[model samples]
Target: MTEDEALELLIPGVKSKKLSLEDERKSKDLVKMLGYLPLAIDQVRGFLTEAGYATSIDKYVDVFEKHKEKVIKPVGVVPNAMVQRSNLYTTFELSLAPFVEAGNEPALRILMLGAFFGLAPIDEAIFLEYRKVQPAEARPAMPAQDPWDQIRFRRTVLSLAEQSLVKLHSQQDRFAYSLHPMIREWLRLRVDTNPRSVITWRPWT
Candidate 1:
């Protein structure tokens, strides 16, 4: 309904003895409608998987269990990302070499870190657990990915944007860049590519 029509339908209840009459009728109507609520609950529970309830007996079988009352069970996923990691490293050797030559160390670091995080922007649990070193230890002199780090990262982003290795996504208040498919493919190759070949682009002072 339009705003005018909705306003017309509203009673705009007044504060008076008539309020009790209205309340009584409304309460009766509510109770009448909800009298069969238990039946409705049973139907809803059967039709939908509530939280903490078992959906299966085992990972491979259908022996369901209850996690909690009304809540469903087995709402978890195991980490099985190793295979994808292995595949990514074998394919993008060519794209990585150029960044090394271009001396884009910050960008290179971000890309490598992205790989370790999986093919996702979300920090992967496995990636977070296996720290080569903390960022402070890893590159102490270089600033963290903070406002200052943006100076270097933004420069790298623009550089990559020029080569179409990355694509920029901008909103009114926030902006970020993502790897182009080619860059994504190359970063995946990090798993298998030679560690020695991946050089830091930071030049000697």
Candidate 2:
């Protein structure tokens, strides 16, 4: 409060935010629960997108058209997820649903890995070098365990294929995947997006 306001508060008194120690602990728990909300929502979004083309729940749900059956709540039920879908999560899923259906978890992981690698062109040999595990630090979930794991290899090819985010071609000997128009088109938009331009300096420009 300003000096004048402080004087007025002394004359009349005012309430302020004060939390008890117990409330602080509860608040921390609430925050931890809230933190997982985004992660759960992300997983659910991925699951639903892989499931099918989802739209607003209201889009297909017509109160007039729906018939109530013997149940108290009424048997003719459309889904809530199907009813209200328009935000970025829903829209993105709709765009990528086909590929997701064609390519599941393995595929999605592969595509994300490619995105991380600057959307570079990739083939099995190149993929082997980049994707292979270090002998000193290999984990069970990594690719090196079973080199002939088609399940592991195809996960990547299908994901890129489904999003139209990549161009995938294969020869008799190996498979090749390259960044599709998606990243190429998206890159141009980042020309002046250097919020950290201070750190992103040049040697001679």
Candidate 3:
């Protein structure tokens, strides 16, 4: 998206209140900070619209600057990649920060595991099937409900979808999901840095 397009997306249906010049400038700064990626822009829209957020665009940008590096690391950069992976990392890190702060580890784990499933449309049943074969004792611990359960799993996936981290698709009557190829590469880059996790999950992938 162009900067103007991204700004429009950042604030849709805003006839109710006019933004100050400073606010408009901050909005443009945010759009550029998000690297003009539509997915990142949409995720920022969702974050800003949440009732619990209770902050102005400038303040959110201030907070984002302070804490972005703490959330996700940039790695495995290559020349001529289609999108700006570093900016996506920062944007995605911001999206997941709330969940991380609230100790929603299950959502985090499910996200990481999905990256191993390749860049294809992931059938939701894969999680269930994996859970069925792996003993409960062998499964990784979840801070809350076992996300492997169909109901809990779907909810987690929906949460991820809302953040624009995963794209939800309905195939026939069933659910499947996909990630943008750049996003998938970023996720795999994340996994590559965590050796223990790679060892535990590689065979299954």
Worst 10 residues of 3 by lDDT: 196-205
lDDT (tens digit, per residue) of candidate 2 on 53-148: 253223212211231111112222233432221122232334344545574545544544454345556666765664454342443223443455
A best-first ranking of the candidates according to their TM-score comes to 3, 2, 1
**Candidate 1 Cα misplacement greater than 4 A, ranges:** 1-97, 116-135, 138-147, 180-185, 192-205
Cα RMSD, each candidate: 21.6, 22.5, 4.9
TM-score of each: 0.34, 0.35, 0.77
lDDT of 1 by residue, 1-205 (tens): 3322222222222233354655445433322322223222222222122222343112201111121111111212121333222222211222234567676566566565454333333222322333434454454323245324445655776654443444565556445555534345434432333454332322212
Task: Put down candidate 3 lDDT per residue, 1-205, tens digits, no spaces.
Answer: 8787898888885434587888788888889877888988888887887635487787878877675554343443542353466667667767877777787766777677666677778887776676667765565532234545677767877888887878998767688888877677666766543544432222112
Residue 131 error, candidate 2, Å: 5.5
Where is model 2 poorest over a 10-residue stretch in terms of lDDT? 196-205
Cα lDDT listed for each candidate: 0.36, 0.39, 0.69
Model 1 residue 12 CA deviation (Å) reads 65
